[model samples]
Target: HRATFTFDLTGMASKTTNSRGMLPDMRSNLYAAVLAGLAYPGINGHPLTEAYGVRQRFIAIVTDLELPNDPLTVLSTCDECDRVCLRACPTRALAGEMKQLTIENTSIPFPLFDTFACDWAKRYSLNAQEGPQYWGVDESYPVPENRTAEEVVKAVTRTDWGVQKLHLNVAEECLRVCPARGTR
Candidate 1:
């Protein structure tokens, strides 16, 4: 959906009903105030217009909203908007104080949060087994079946090839569970 623009599927010039969306659903909000927070905070005294590099980039948008020119107001979600994402994430990447794994850490894997990743994981996770079982197994990742625990630790912490291997083996489920509310 358009973040600031709307289109009429019925071919009306504009919507006769609500111009912006009515309200966000309280049950399944995925933004949880972090990634979504970044969208409108107006980094460096400008606005998301600067940070997002586009006038249109937004997060957790259930439908197009009538955000005012004031960027701070864009973050006002209703109370009790259940952050299913906090519960859904296998990793505790989000925080009570700090939220979200930076793109530097996760998007190479999971801060890779995108509408497509979330939607696909939701569909794929229904089968459970179909989703990768190694949900939070980042620690055990570098070690195979026969490797000892000490060997595993040594392999994972080193800056050598083992670190690269661990990075490669990281699961991205943390990013995939967040549902996207708007079109990319």
Candidate 2:
């Protein structure tokens, strides 16, 4: 069995001091998923979505009960998109390539990206070009051309900028501007 929890972030203010107001929403969805898992007694679930904000969490669950295969419609509109999501990345983390992953004999194609660079820009709010200016975080740490998880962490810590405090900024521009979701 599979479950999907959709969070609609439309009409919400983009810039905020509280992690763009996503933590609470994420927690709610997480709790729901947990409860659902518990109710199933002997179910195992795995999350499929990577990005935060206005996203769907697809949980592929396994159970003893037999169920019909009801595959969700793939968003083929991404193929026709102008690649706005890729261009919106302040760190240019998206590789602009489609990679396929086969799950349950179904091929899922998604855009490839540098996870380290993406986390640096989105999670840490390090990229000034990505609206860190809203938080008064003017420092734009350079993403290593060959970024590793360790190197990204070092770059953030080595800076004189206070790394301990929370730096709030609008993130997930790639997800926000996706025409597939009608967000554009």
- The number of the candidate with the highest lDDT is 2
Worst 10 residues of 1 by lDDT: 10-19
lDDT of 2 by residue, 1-184 (tens): 5543344223221122245354322112332332332111000011122132225442234356665644433333554558677777777777576555564565655445566666676666667656666556677887877667677678767645545366465546665565443332
For each candidate, give its TM-score against the true structure. 0.26, 0.57
Q: Local error of candidate 1 at 21, Å?
A: 39
State, as a TM-score between 0 and 1, how close model 2 is to the true structure: 0.57
All models, RMSD in angstroms: 17.2, 9.8
- Deviation from native of the Cα of residue 56 in model 2, angstroms: 3.8
Residue pairs with backbone atoms closer than 3 Å in model 1 (clashes):
1-183, 42-47, 106-110, 106-111, 107-112
lDDT of 1 by residue, 1-184 (tens): 4543223222211111111322221112223223333443211111122223212322243346555442222431211235444555443323323223444233211122222222222222211222333442222232133434454344435423222222122223432333333233
lDDT, candidate 1, at 128: 25
lDDT of 1 at 99: 27
Best by TM-score: 2
